[model samples]
Every structure is written in structure tokens, then in C-alpha cells.
Target: MTTGTIREIDSASVDADGMLSRTMRILGCFTADEPELSASRLGALTGLSSSTLHRILAQMLDLGLLSRTPGRRYAVGVRLWELGELSPLALRLRETALPYMTRLYEATGENVHLAVLDAPAPERATALYVGRLTGRGSIPTLSRMGGRQPLHTTGVGKALLAMQSGDWIDRFLAQPLERETMYSITEPDAIRMEIDRARARGYATTREEMTLGNVSVAAPVGSIAGLPPAALGVVTRIDGADTRRLGALVTQTAADLGRALRAL
Candidate 1:
């Protein structure tokens, strides 16, 4: 027996053009709304033939990149989640911020969130939530762990935006902001004013901007080594909510978490 290079067997389904790109295309088809997809649906979404789709799905399943579900549908595998947990944002930042976020939740009985800036460019920045805690008594929120939200419409988002450089902020505000609700501040100058207030007050506030009946108070966590800018915030029902008090609490918690991360 002699060692030899291995290659794919002759198959019309095999695509040699862009292995990485095609894999990403398949994975990207699964979203927060639809986590599991069947081969037919994936073929339609990716424009790949059934044979090619089935071949790639089989390879991904064996590698633990995807797993099969009932009715032959496939989902993101647990191995991907295990790898995500190894990221510094997860192991260090999210784990470190969990205790402080829990304290905020207990003190206010509201939805507490920890998020980091996901800015490839000034205009493309978003708040990427890393951790969230909510109680049964807490009002429902559109945010979830690992979800992205607009920086101009959410408290934690504005807080993160306030930490950017003046030039960066200028570029960020140059684009027209999307209006999430009637109360969402879409005017660039108005959002700039809110960012100014957040900078001066050590926290930011959003009153029914992201959702109709909720108010959020958030504060930025000062710089941490090897980590993107982060913020923590609380969301509660707007009625009878004391944003002032919540602001004070959020400010303190964010500061404390920043100190803890630096010490580590």
C-alpha cells in the first residue's frame, strides 16, 4: 500500500468554485427566526442543486458544524456554540459582567442587558447583546442574547455610541437613522444631542424608542483591554418607571463591571 492524495470522487453535484463562500451561504440562511431548515428549503435559498446541498449537509453534519433534526431538517450544531463560548467576549466579558447584570436585575426587577459595540464602520455600528436577564414580572423586550439592535434607538446602544471619538461619532451620525417607532429619534442632530447628554450624565435613556411601552436606562462600561466598548442597561415598563433612579443604578453597575474587567 502507498500513501496518495485524496480527492472527491467524480460527481456532478460537486462545486469547486467557492467552498468557503458556499458554506457561509448555507449557514447564513438560518436566522434567529428560522434556526432549522430542510434540504429543499436550503437549496432554494442557496440556489444550489439538491445533490450539492445534500453532499454539503452530510459533510457539515459529520464535522459537527450542523446537526440533523426530525423530518431531515438541519440546525446549527452544539459545537458551534461551544466554539462561540471560547471567544474572549464570551469567556471574559460576558462571564465577568453577569454578576453585575444580575444585581441590576434584582434591584430593579427589570430586564438587564450587556452589549458591546459591533462597528466595522461608523455608519454600520450596532449594539450586539452578549447577556440578558429578565424576570417573570419584567415587561417583554425585543432584545435577546446575541441579537443586534440599532444604536440610536436603544439605551445601551446610545451609551456605546457616546464612547466613540468625536470624528467617529460625526461619521456615525452622518447617516439617516432608521425609525423603529413613532417616538424613535431619527434626526441626526437630535441623536447627537442625546449622545451629548449621555456623555455628560454618565448614562443614556430611551423612552419607548425601541418598543412602544418600555423605557431603558443604560451606561457605558469604560475601556477594557482586548475588548470592544461595552454597555449595560435595564429595560422596564415606561409607566411609573423612574428613569432617574434607574439611570443612577445602571451608571454604578457599568462602572463596577468596568473596574472588575480591568482588574482581571
Candidate 2:
């Protein structure tokens, strides 16, 4: 057996082995900006010794969780990507929302997004972006596929939040909320009112809340039976766009996507 295989066997023999956690930490070291790294760099980032890091990396390589690049740096392997594609919440939502998102982008010439709520936490709530479609002249945003954003400041986030129970909303509001931009709502009562409005209107909107000069309108991608699995939104420049009309379009698109998901 190869050294990596031997190490894997040895690690598995030990009860309550920390190898899994260390391996996860190594994988977590990579990001959108830093997709690849040398073993030494990974060791620095993860605080793992060279010998232990290399051994775990070798096992990961053997398992196809990571691959070595031409420069001997490592990156997440195609197997990881393949596994991510199998996720029901992220991949299924992306597949179901893509056609409608594209249609919304084409019709409005704006940036379209589909996001799902992260599991509820005591400290905060977040939205995980699953898919996006950028229009020809759409304003730039910090969001990326698989990236996360705070639930309070984003349109999709607010739409998803509006579907939560009142007690859950209160708990979320009790957490520390960052003011992302000048217009971001920081007061708990203000956000509570906003959530009430969104729940009442069947859609949500934010004007320069998450980012300056950007406005977004969104609706939940499911019914009020429970918290939505996803939300659909469009982002545009605040100055020239008719936000009310765009809001109507996004609400309709979200309803259509919701219906499609239900049929599945």
C-alpha cells in the first residue's frame, strides 16, 4: 500500500482520531481568491505541521478530495465539485431557479440571484447564494456562487427572513447586526417593521442597504407554510431603475419558480 493508504489505515485504527477535523481545516483554507496553495502555505494557514499536513493531503489526494497542480500546489478536486453538485438544497435549487432567473435577467436587464437560508443559528442568520445571472449592464456585487451574506441587509435575505416565525425573527434581531452601508437598517424595531412589510406585500426590497448605489427586490421562492428554501431577487442601480415595476417582475418570477419547485 502507498504511504497515504497506510496513514489512512493507521488513522482509522485510532479511536476518536482528529485526522478528519484536520483534513477539513486544510480544505477550509482555500477560498475564492486562494483556490490553490502549496503544502507549506496550507500548513501555515491551518497550523498543521508539515509531516501531518502532507500525510493528510496525500490521503485526500488518494481519495480525490484534492489534486496537485502543475506548480505542486493543491486545489479542490473535481470530485469535490461533483459532490457539491449532488447537494439537494444548493444544486437542486440552482437547477430549478436558473431558467426563471435567466428569464428575469433578460426581461429586466438586471442582476438576478437565487439564495437559500443557512441553518438557523442563535447568533445570526445568513443566506447562501446558489445561482446568479448577470445582465449586460448590471451593477457589480460582492456575491458569488456559494458565497454567503447576512440575512438582514440583502433583498433575498429579507425575503427569506420574512417567512420565519415571529419568535425566530425576534431572536435573529436580538443578535448584533452590522450596518453594511449608510442606509442599512441597524435598529431592531426598524428591521422588525421591514420584515412585517415584506410579509404583508409578498416581496421585499432594499435600497443601498447591502452595497452603496445598488437596489434589490426579492420574493420568497416558496409559500408561507414554513421558511422558504430559497429566495429570488434582481439587483440594479438605484438612480435610473423603476424599482416598483422590477419588484413586481421579481415577485412573479419567484412565484413561478416556487410553483416549479413544488411540482418536482
- RMSD of each candidate relative to the true structure: 7.2, 5.6
Report lDDT per candidate: 0.87, 0.82
Q: How accurate is candidate 2 locally (lDDT)?
A: 0.82
State model 1's lDDT.
0.87
- Tens digit per residue, CA lDDT, model 1, 154-216: 999999989998899889889888899999998878988999999999999999999999999
Candidate 2, which ten residues in sequence have the lowest lDDT sum? 1-10
Tell me the TM-score of each prediction against the true structure: 0.92, 0.89
lDDT of 2 by residue, 1-264 (tens): 011122234344444777776776777778767888998899898898888988999999999999989899999887887887877755467777789998998898888999887753635468888888995688999898878888889999999888888888878878789999989998999998989999888889999999999999999988523334689999899998787798799999999988887777
Using TM-score, give the best candidate's number. Answer: 1
Misplaced by over 4 Å in model 2 are: 1-15, 120-122, 223-228
